[model samples]
Target: MRTRTEENPDYCAIESAMEVLGGRWKLAILKQLTPGTLRFGELGRALPAITPRMLTRQLRELETDGLVTRTVYREVPPRVEYTLTDAAHRLDAIMSQLDTWGRWYRDTVRPGDAERVT
Candidate 1:
Protein backbone atom coordinates (compact mmCIF):
# COMPACT_ATOMS: atom_id res chain seq x y z
CA MET A 1 0.00 0.00 0.00
CA ARG A 2 1.21 3.46 -0.94
CA THR A 3 1.14 5.79 2.05
CA ARG A 4 0.26 9.47 1.88
CA THR A 5 3.92 10.33 2.36
CA GLU A 6 4.81 8.28 -0.69
CA GLU A 7 1.99 9.59 -2.86
CA ASN A 8 2.28 13.27 -1.88
CA PRO A 9 5.74 14.68 -2.07
CA ASP A 10 4.50 17.91 -0.56
CA TYR A 11 3.26 16.34 2.64
CA CYS A 12 4.59 17.70 5.92
CA ALA A 13 7.55 16.03 7.56
CA ILE A 14 5.32 14.93 10.45
CA GLU A 15 3.30 12.90 8.00
CA SER A 16 6.38 10.92 7.10
CA ALA A 17 7.06 10.30 10.78
CA MET A 18 3.48 9.24 11.49
CA GLU A 19 3.70 6.78 8.62
CA VAL A 20 6.31 4.88 10.60
CA LEU A 21 5.10 5.40 14.18
CA GLY A 22 1.44 6.47 14.20
CA GLY A 23 -0.18 3.06 14.53
CA ARG A 24 -1.92 1.99 17.73
CA TRP A 25 0.79 -0.52 18.60
CA LYS A 26 4.02 0.88 17.17
CA LEU A 27 4.64 3.42 19.90
CA ALA A 28 3.77 0.87 22.53
CA ILE A 29 6.24 -1.57 21.05
CA LEU A 30 8.94 1.07 20.93
CA LYS A 31 8.27 2.06 24.52
CA GLN A 32 8.66 -1.54 25.59
CA LEU A 33 12.08 -1.69 24.00
CA THR A 34 13.30 1.53 25.58
CA PRO A 35 14.81 -0.24 28.57
CA GLY A 36 16.91 -2.75 26.63
CA THR A 37 16.67 -5.83 24.42
CA LEU A 38 13.76 -8.25 24.91
CA ARG A 39 12.75 -11.51 23.36
CA PHE A 40 9.53 -12.02 21.39
CA GLY A 41 7.79 -13.88 24.21
CA GLU A 42 8.90 -11.27 26.74
CA LEU A 43 7.32 -8.55 24.64
CA GLY A 44 4.12 -10.55 24.38
CA ARG A 45 4.06 -10.97 28.15
CA ALA A 46 4.48 -7.26 28.73
CA LEU A 47 1.65 -6.47 26.31
CA PRO A 48 -0.84 -9.04 27.42
CA ALA A 49 -3.64 -7.63 25.30
CA ILE A 50 -1.83 -8.14 22.01
CA THR A 51 -2.11 -11.45 20.29
CA PRO A 52 0.96 -13.30 19.07
CA ARG A 53 0.09 -12.60 15.44
CA MET A 54 -0.41 -8.87 15.97
CA LEU A 55 2.79 -8.64 17.99
CA THR A 56 4.75 -10.30 15.21
CA ARG A 57 3.23 -7.97 12.61
CA GLN A 58 4.00 -4.81 14.58
CA LEU A 59 7.56 -5.97 15.28
CA ARG A 60 8.11 -6.59 11.57
CA GLU A 61 6.89 -3.09 10.71
CA LEU A 62 9.14 -1.55 13.43
CA GLU A 63 12.07 -3.48 11.99
CA THR A 64 11.28 -2.27 8.47
CA ASP A 65 11.13 1.32 9.70
CA GLY A 66 14.64 1.05 11.20
CA LEU A 67 13.28 1.73 14.67
CA VAL A 68 14.17 -1.72 15.98
CA THR A 69 16.74 -4.39 15.30
CA ARG A 70 16.03 -8.11 15.45
CA THR A 71 18.78 -10.59 16.28
CA VAL A 72 18.60 -14.33 16.17
CA TYR A 73 20.87 -16.57 18.25
CA ARG A 74 21.51 -20.10 17.10
CA GLU A 75 21.16 -21.44 20.62
CA VAL A 76 19.59 -24.69 21.65
CA PRO A 77 16.07 -23.29 21.47
CA PRO A 78 16.86 -20.69 18.81
CA ARG A 79 16.50 -17.39 20.63
CA VAL A 80 15.54 -14.06 19.05
CA GLU A 81 15.77 -10.61 20.60
CA TYR A 82 14.82 -7.06 19.68
CA THR A 83 16.43 -3.76 20.54
CA LEU A 84 15.55 -0.20 19.71
CA THR A 85 17.83 1.48 17.18
CA ASP A 86 19.48 4.87 17.65
CA ALA A 87 16.69 6.55 15.74
CA ALA A 88 14.17 5.16 18.19
CA HIS A 89 16.28 6.12 21.20
CA ARG A 90 16.20 9.72 19.99
CA LEU A 91 12.44 9.75 20.66
CA ASP A 92 12.79 8.97 24.36
CA ALA A 93 12.20 12.52 25.51
CA ILE A 94 9.31 12.95 23.13
CA MET A 95 7.77 9.71 24.32
CA SER A 96 8.08 10.83 27.92
CA GLN A 97 6.27 14.06 27.09
CA LEU A 98 3.56 12.12 25.34
CA ASP A 99 3.17 9.90 28.37
CA THR A 100 2.78 12.88 30.65
CA TRP A 101 0.20 14.40 28.33
CA GLY A 102 -1.69 11.15 28.18
CA ARG A 103 -1.80 10.99 31.95
CA TRP A 104 -3.13 14.55 32.12
CA TYR A 105 -5.75 13.83 29.52
CA ARG A 106 -6.94 10.75 31.31
CA ASP A 107 -7.03 12.50 34.64
CA THR A 108 -8.55 15.84 33.68
CA VAL A 109 -10.34 15.45 30.39
CA ARG A 110 -11.83 12.00 30.75
CA PRO A 111 -11.75 11.08 34.40
CA GLY A 112 -15.11 9.34 34.41
CA ASP A 113 -15.05 7.85 30.94
CA ALA A 114 -12.72 4.96 31.44
CA GLU A 115 -15.12 2.49 29.83
CA ARG A 116 -15.43 4.47 26.62
CA VAL A 117 -11.73 5.33 26.52
CA THR A 118 -10.86 1.68 26.48
Candidate 2:
Protein backbone atom coordinates (compact mmCIF):
# COMPACT_ATOMS: atom_id res chain seq x y z
CA MET A 1 0.00 0.00 0.00
CA ARG A 2 1.17 3.54 -0.82
CA THR A 3 1.34 6.23 1.82
CA ARG A 4 -0.54 9.44 1.14
CA THR A 5 0.69 12.89 2.10
CA GLU A 6 -0.78 16.35 1.84
CA GLU A 7 2.05 17.52 -0.42
CA ASN A 8 1.67 14.69 -2.96
CA PRO A 9 -1.48 12.76 -3.93
CA ASP A 10 -2.48 10.43 -6.75
CA TYR A 11 -5.32 8.28 -5.51
CA CYS A 12 -9.04 8.38 -6.19
CA ALA A 13 -11.63 9.49 -3.63
CA ILE A 14 -12.73 5.93 -2.91
CA GLU A 15 -9.15 4.93 -2.21
CA SER A 16 -8.79 7.86 0.16
CA ALA A 17 -11.95 6.81 2.00
CA MET A 18 -10.68 3.25 2.17
CA GLU A 19 -7.41 4.47 3.62
CA VAL A 20 -9.31 5.59 6.72
CA LEU A 21 -12.16 3.12 6.56
CA GLY A 22 -10.08 0.12 5.50
CA GLY A 23 -9.61 -3.15 7.41
CA ARG A 24 -12.33 -5.40 8.83
CA TRP A 25 -12.65 -3.71 12.21
CA LYS A 26 -12.83 0.03 11.47
CA LEU A 27 -16.25 -0.17 9.85
CA ALA A 28 -17.53 -2.46 12.58
CA ILE A 29 -16.25 -0.08 15.23
CA LEU A 30 -17.93 2.84 13.51
CA LYS A 31 -21.19 0.91 13.27
CA GLN A 32 -21.08 0.21 16.99
CA LEU A 33 -20.51 3.88 17.73
CA THR A 34 -23.18 4.97 15.28
CA PRO A 35 -25.89 4.90 17.93
CA GLY A 36 -23.90 6.83 20.55
CA THR A 37 -20.68 7.05 22.49
CA LEU A 38 -19.25 3.82 23.93
CA ARG A 39 -16.49 2.94 26.35
CA PHE A 40 -13.47 0.83 25.49
CA GLY A 41 -14.91 -2.21 27.23
CA GLU A 42 -18.25 -1.84 25.47
CA LEU A 43 -16.56 -1.62 22.11
CA GLY A 44 -14.48 -4.68 22.91
CA ARG A 45 -17.59 -6.64 23.79
CA ALA A 46 -19.35 -5.49 20.62
CA LEU A 47 -16.48 -6.69 18.46
CA PRO A 48 -15.55 -9.90 20.17
CA ALA A 49 -13.31 -11.05 17.31
CA ILE A 50 -10.98 -8.02 17.60
CA THR A 51 -8.04 -8.07 19.94
CA PRO A 52 -7.70 -5.24 22.45
CA ARG A 53 -4.41 -4.01 20.95
CA MET A 54 -5.80 -3.98 17.42
CA LEU A 55 -8.92 -2.15 18.59
CA THR A 56 -6.77 0.53 20.22
CA ARG A 57 -4.73 0.92 17.04
CA GLN A 58 -7.83 1.24 14.86
CA LEU A 59 -9.36 3.81 17.24
CA ARG A 60 -6.18 5.86 17.14
CA GLU A 61 -6.19 5.83 13.36
CA LEU A 62 -9.83 6.83 13.25
CA GLU A 63 -9.10 9.72 15.61
CA THR A 64 -6.11 10.81 13.49
CA ASP A 65 -8.24 10.71 10.35
CA GLY A 66 -10.92 12.94 11.93
CA LEU A 67 -13.50 10.16 11.65
CA VAL A 68 -13.75 9.69 15.41
CA THR A 69 -13.21 11.81 18.49
CA ARG A 70 -11.89 10.29 21.71
CA THR A 71 -12.82 12.09 24.90
CA VAL A 72 -11.16 11.29 28.17
CA TYR A 73 -12.78 12.52 31.32
CA ARG A 74 -10.73 13.50 34.33
CA GLU A 75 -11.72 10.99 36.97
CA VAL A 76 -10.23 8.76 39.63
CA PRO A 77 -9.84 5.57 37.63
CA PRO A 78 -10.08 7.39 34.28
CA ARG A 79 -12.86 7.29 31.76
CA VAL A 80 -12.64 7.47 28.00
CA GLU A 81 -15.35 7.58 25.38
CA TYR A 82 -15.47 7.62 21.60
CA THR A 83 -17.94 9.35 19.32
CA LEU A 84 -18.20 9.80 15.58
CA THR A 85 -17.27 13.03 13.89
CA ASP A 86 -19.43 14.79 11.35
CA ALA A 87 -17.51 13.12 8.57
CA ALA A 88 -18.31 9.62 9.82
CA HIS A 89 -21.97 10.43 10.27
CA ARG A 90 -22.01 11.46 6.64
CA LEU A 91 -21.29 7.87 5.70
CA ASP A 92 -24.45 6.53 7.35
CA ALA A 93 -26.47 6.30 4.15
CA ILE A 94 -23.62 4.85 2.14
CA MET A 95 -22.94 2.21 4.76
CA SER A 96 -26.60 1.27 4.92
CA GLN A 97 -26.71 0.80 1.15
CA LEU A 98 -23.60 -1.34 1.25
CA ASP A 99 -25.13 -3.45 4.04
CA THR A 100 -28.21 -4.04 1.93
CA TRP A 101 -26.14 -4.97 -1.10
CA GLY A 102 -23.98 -7.30 0.97
CA ARG A 103 -27.04 -9.11 2.31
CA TRP A 104 -28.43 -9.49 -1.17
CA TYR A 105 -25.18 -10.92 -2.49
CA ARG A 106 -24.82 -13.27 0.45
CA ASP A 107 -28.38 -14.50 0.24
CA THR A 108 -28.69 -14.83 -3.51
CA VAL A 109 -25.17 -15.36 -4.80
CA ARG A 110 -23.67 -17.54 -2.08
CA PRO A 111 -26.32 -18.91 0.19
CA GLY A 112 -24.24 -21.73 1.62
CA ASP A 113 -21.06 -19.67 2.05
CA ALA A 114 -22.65 -17.07 4.34
CA GLU A 115 -23.65 -19.62 6.97
CA ARG A 116 -20.17 -21.11 7.07
CA VAL A 117 -18.44 -17.72 7.43
CA THR A 118 -20.77 -16.41 10.11
Candidate 3:
Protein backbone atom coordinates (compact mmCIF):
# COMPACT_ATOMS: atom_id res chain seq x y z
CA MET A 1 0.00 0.00 0.00
CA ARG A 2 1.16 3.51 -0.74
CA THR A 3 1.96 5.54 2.34
CA ARG A 4 0.89 9.14 2.83
CA THR A 5 4.28 10.30 1.56
CA GLU A 6 4.02 8.07 -1.47
CA GLU A 7 0.63 9.44 -2.34
CA ASN A 8 1.53 13.11 -1.82
CA PRO A 9 4.00 14.55 -4.24
CA ASP A 10 4.27 17.78 -2.29
CA TYR A 11 5.88 16.48 0.85
CA CYS A 12 8.58 18.77 2.25
CA ALA A 13 12.01 17.65 3.40
CA ILE A 14 10.84 17.31 7.00
CA GLU A 15 8.04 15.03 5.94
CA SER A 16 10.54 12.84 4.09
CA ALA A 17 12.63 12.60 7.23
CA MET A 18 9.57 11.79 9.30
CA GLU A 19 8.71 9.01 6.86
CA VAL A 20 12.08 7.44 7.62
CA LEU A 21 12.13 8.03 11.37
CA GLY A 22 8.46 8.05 12.35
CA GLY A 23 8.12 4.54 13.79
CA ARG A 24 8.03 3.94 17.56
CA TRP A 25 11.33 2.05 17.62
CA LYS A 26 13.47 3.76 14.96
CA LEU A 27 14.47 6.80 17.00
CA ALA A 28 15.22 4.67 20.06
CA ILE A 29 17.33 2.30 17.98
CA LEU A 30 19.22 5.24 16.46
CA LYS A 31 19.84 6.75 19.88
CA GLN A 32 21.22 3.45 21.16
CA LEU A 33 23.58 3.16 18.21
CA THR A 34 24.78 6.72 18.58
CA PRO A 35 27.37 5.76 21.19
CA GLY A 36 29.16 3.07 19.21
CA THR A 37 28.85 -0.22 17.48
CA LEU A 38 26.79 -2.80 19.35
CA ARG A 39 26.14 -6.47 18.85
CA PHE A 40 22.62 -7.71 18.26
CA GLY A 41 22.42 -9.09 21.76
CA GLU A 42 23.76 -5.85 23.22
CA LEU A 43 21.12 -3.86 21.38
CA GLY A 44 18.42 -6.20 22.59
CA ARG A 45 19.56 -5.77 26.19
CA ALA A 46 19.80 -1.98 25.85
CA LEU A 47 16.23 -1.84 24.65
CA PRO A 48 14.57 -4.60 26.62
CA ALA A 49 11.15 -3.29 25.66
CA ILE A 50 11.72 -4.08 21.98
CA THR A 51 11.03 -7.58 20.74
CA PRO A 52 13.73 -9.48 18.90
CA ARG A 53 11.65 -9.52 15.71
CA MET A 54 10.94 -5.79 15.87
CA LEU A 55 14.56 -4.94 16.59
CA THR A 56 15.73 -6.97 13.64
CA ARG A 57 13.19 -5.33 11.37
CA GLN A 58 14.04 -1.79 12.49
CA LEU A 59 17.77 -2.45 12.14
CA ARG A 60 17.26 -3.76 8.63
CA GLU A 61 15.22 -0.72 7.69
CA LEU A 62 17.79 1.68 9.16
CA GLU A 63 20.57 -0.09 7.32
CA THR A 64 18.64 0.10 4.10
CA ASP A 65 18.06 3.82 4.63
CA GLY A 66 21.83 4.51 4.86
CA LEU A 67 21.51 5.64 8.46
CA VAL A 68 23.22 2.58 9.90
CA THR A 69 25.81 0.05 8.88
CA ARG A 70 26.02 -3.63 9.78
CA THR A 71 29.30 -5.48 9.80
CA VAL A 72 29.81 -9.22 10.11
CA TYR A 73 32.95 -11.00 11.23
CA ARG A 74 33.85 -14.55 10.27
CA GLU A 75 34.85 -16.54 13.33
CA VAL A 76 34.13 -19.67 15.33
CA PRO A 77 30.99 -17.88 16.38
CA PRO A 78 30.11 -15.19 13.87
CA ARG A 79 29.95 -11.67 15.26
CA VAL A 80 27.75 -8.89 13.96
CA GLU A 81 27.78 -5.23 14.93
CA TYR A 82 25.73 -2.17 14.02
CA THR A 83 26.83 1.46 13.94
CA LEU A 84 25.48 4.73 12.75
CA THR A 85 26.76 6.03 9.43
CA ASP A 86 28.20 9.50 8.86
CA ALA A 87 24.84 10.56 7.54
CA ALA A 88 23.24 9.47 10.75
CA HIS A 89 25.97 11.12 12.78
CA ARG A 90 25.16 14.37 11.03
CA LEU A 91 21.76 14.20 12.65
CA ASP A 92 23.26 14.63 16.11
CA ALA A 93 22.66 18.37 16.13
CA ILE A 94 19.05 17.99 15.08
CA MET A 95 18.46 15.27 17.61
CA SER A 96 19.97 17.41 20.32
CA GLN A 97 17.68 20.27 19.39
CA LEU A 98 14.74 17.91 19.50
CA ASP A 99 15.84 16.72 22.92
CA THR A 100 16.07 20.30 24.12
CA TRP A 101 12.63 21.04 22.73
CA GLY A 102 11.23 18.00 24.51
CA ARG A 103 12.65 19.17 27.83
CA TRP A 104 11.35 22.70 27.30
CA TYR A 105 7.93 21.45 26.35
CA ARG A 106 7.76 19.22 29.37
CA ASP A 107 8.89 21.94 31.72
CA THR A 108 6.82 24.75 30.33
CA VAL A 109 3.74 22.97 29.05
CA ARG A 110 3.48 19.95 31.28
CA PRO A 111 5.32 21.09 34.38
CA GLY A 112 3.25 19.33 37.01
CA ASP A 113 2.26 16.52 34.71
CA ALA A 114 5.78 15.14 34.45
CA GLU A 115 5.16 12.64 37.25
CA ARG A 116 1.86 11.56 35.77
CA VAL A 117 1.91 8.14 34.16
CA THR A 118 0.25 7.49 30.85
User: Candidate 3 overall Cα lDDT vs. reference?
Assistant: 0.85
lDDT of 2: 0.87
Which has the greatest lDDT?
1
Query: What lDDT tens digits, residue by residue, belong to model 2 across residues 1-118?
Result: 4356343456556667777888989988998999999999999999999999999999999999899999999998899999999999998998888889888776677655655553
For each candidate in turn, the TM-score is 0.86, 0.83, 0.78
Please tell me which model should have the higher TM-score, number 1 or number 3: 1
Where model 3 places Cα greater than 4 Å from the true spot, the runs are 1-11, 104-118
Tens digits of lDDT, candidate 1, 4-23: 55654565778788888887
Clashing pairs in 2: none
Clashes of 1: 0
Candidate 2 Cα deviation (angstroms), residue 104: 2.0
Screening candidate 3 with a backbone cut-off below 3 angstroms (N, C-alpha, C), the clashing residue pairs are none
**For model 3, what is the error of residue 69's alpha carbon versus the real structure, in angstroms, after optimal superposition?**
0.4
